[model samples]
Target: MTTKRILLYAALAAGAFISVFPYLLVVLTAFKTKAQLNSTEPWLPGVPPTLDNLGRLLGGDFPQYILNTVIMTVLLTLGQLVFTTFAAYAFARLRFRGRDVLFWLYMATMMVPSAVTMIPLFLIMRELDLVNTWYGLLAPYILGTPYGIFLMRQFFKGLPAGLEEAARIDGAGPLTVLVRILLPLCRPALGTLTIITVISSWNSFLWPLIITSGDATKVVTVAIAALKVGIGVDYNLMMAGGLIALAPMVAVFVFFQKYIVRSVVLTGLK
Candidate 1:
């Protein structure tokens, strides 16, 4: 091989190792005992791998945290897909008075940092008496995001108008065209949106932290933070919790990463 090509391959290999090393350390540390974790070489494999940390995690409120996270992620993702799909279809295919202006106005919200809206949203949830409920935890996200709407709209716009026109000629209404025609063809975009929404909701900490109290509504991210108690950091336990929290996201990326790449390519989303 050419020297340039060899250098490129070496650079890629170095980048991959650098990206994966921290996660590898976390996984390895999860198996270590407390003593091993406190040692200078905590990144080394445990002398004898132990399930004690995993057992304690599972036996504690962690399972509930997992369940809560799953429920919130699934519901929020589904809600976003449904809401954004309809909004995108409208924005893409349907002509309305001031449609472009309105869509642009809505999309402009994306420029606002989420942190800026958190306080107002919290107050709104509080006004509705949803402060400590799962609904409150999910309210901000269950509604579609500007980015999701934009992504779906771009994908929808790329689709041939003839598909919807043909469906309409067969007496299919707008809803029918969306459900039976557009949605089926937009699987890659849908999958991409689903993965994004799931990951975002799963990793959400600040919103859940502000809206929830105690263990009742705590998601895994918040629950994992709870692992740090007044006592010194239990590195092994913390690593174990981190692994548990990370496993689903890793599984999801492994499964849907192809769809994400395909969607980005097809939709021309950078």
Candidate 2:
């Protein structure tokens, strides 16, 4: 048993090293000068790495890109949380006409490839004169996604019925019960949903690239891609921007990691 434990630890360590090495390399490369970056020994930066590239990115539109990404992600996440929670509540508690069929149909959308719908979405945006605008960029995400609904439904289903029942008995309407009792108890699920929604919106590339053509509406992912060309592919500036873009996601994950894990565990428990 001791030997088996030793092997398992060794394997896990090896896996961790493999996963972390690329990011370390990227970070190291980001500190190197162009001459050093292009050199055969570019894999490692020397004793005193410079922050020149970071400075350059900070001086450019990278700051604006970061701001835009934050705004867009926050807006989209807020909309998703409200919409998904309500939809999930309805599906889990309410008895209505075609509820099951409608839910099934919504879930069916998860199976469809996003690429298949891009053209139609683009055309609709154009028709609405929302193209090249922040509203246009965020409009698609404002509608709660199928995956969000599905996740919330699962979490909502796992909730005990007693609390809601007690609230109803206390002269609480459905909305009152949801707002006062259900939602407060749903902190773990809400945290999980926020983490997922924020990450997806932050990392989104293709849709933002296709829809927003100007800086006014461009998101971090698209901005990052443009940086490659804008700075003549200056590796350090690009890396700095990449790191900046990733900071919010990392902070969010760190903050809510416990609840996110709990939510996942509970989903499986049900």
Candidate 3:
């Protein structure tokens, strides 16, 4: 290889290592024993690795935490898909008066950080006595977000109008066109939104932490945070929790990353 190309590859490799090394350290540390983790040795685990940390977790309530996280993520993603798609279809296709103004007004909510709304939401949930229930945990999120609606709406607006027009000519209703014709073609956009929602919902810590009490309703993120308690940290256990919390998102990104690219490409085309 040319010297310039060699330098480029070297720089890229270095940057990759910088980006990945912390996660690599977490993975390595999870497999290490308590004694090994306490030692000065920075990266490598001693002699044999151990499953004791992970085993301890899986042997107990961590699986429940995993389940809670899964339940929330799945429900949240599905709700976002249904609600965002419908709202986007309306904003994109329907010609109701004040549609643009209404959408922009709704979208303005995005400018407000979620932290600002949490107190009011909590108070409302408290007033309704919904706190700590599944409804309480999910009700705030299941309607989806302005960003998702905006993304879906932009994608919907980009499609060739002829397809929907042709479907209309065939006596297809709007819902029929949305479900059978338009949605299928929107696979890339939907997939993009699904993955985004799944990742965000899965990693959500603050809302779940604030809303949930006890082990029952706490998701994996809260569970992981619970590892570092009081004065000291249990590195072995904490690292293991970190690994467990991270795996699903990594798998999700690896699998659905293509859809993100496709959405970008398709949207850019319009």
Query: Clash pairs of candidate 1?
Result: none
- Please list all clashing residue pairs in model 3, or write none if there are none: none
Q: Give the TM-score of candidate 2.
A: 0.92
Instruction: Give candidate 2's whole-model lDDT.
Output: 0.83
What TM-score against the true fold does each predicted structure earn? Answer: 0.94, 0.92, 0.94
Scanning candidate 2 in windows of ten residues, the lowest lDDT window is: 39-48
- Please write out the lDDT profile of model 1 over residues 1-270, one tens digit for every residue: 999999999999999999999999889988988787766484579778899999999998899889988888889988999998999999999999999999999999999999999999999999999998988988787879999999999889889999999999999999999999989999888888887788888999999989999677889989888889996888788889999999988997787788767766755653
lDDT of each: 0.88, 0.83, 0.89
The C-alpha stretches of model 3 lying farther than 4 A from their native spots are 263-270
Residue 132 CA displacement from its true place in model 1, Å: 1.2
Question: Per-residue CA lDDT of candidate 2, range 1-270, in tens?
Answer: 699999999999999999877777767876777777776375576447878877887888878888898898899999999988899899989899999999999899889999898889999999999889987788887779988888888877888999888888889998998788888888877887788788889999999999999988888889778866643667776676777776777787688788778867865664
Better of 1 and 3 by lDDT: 3
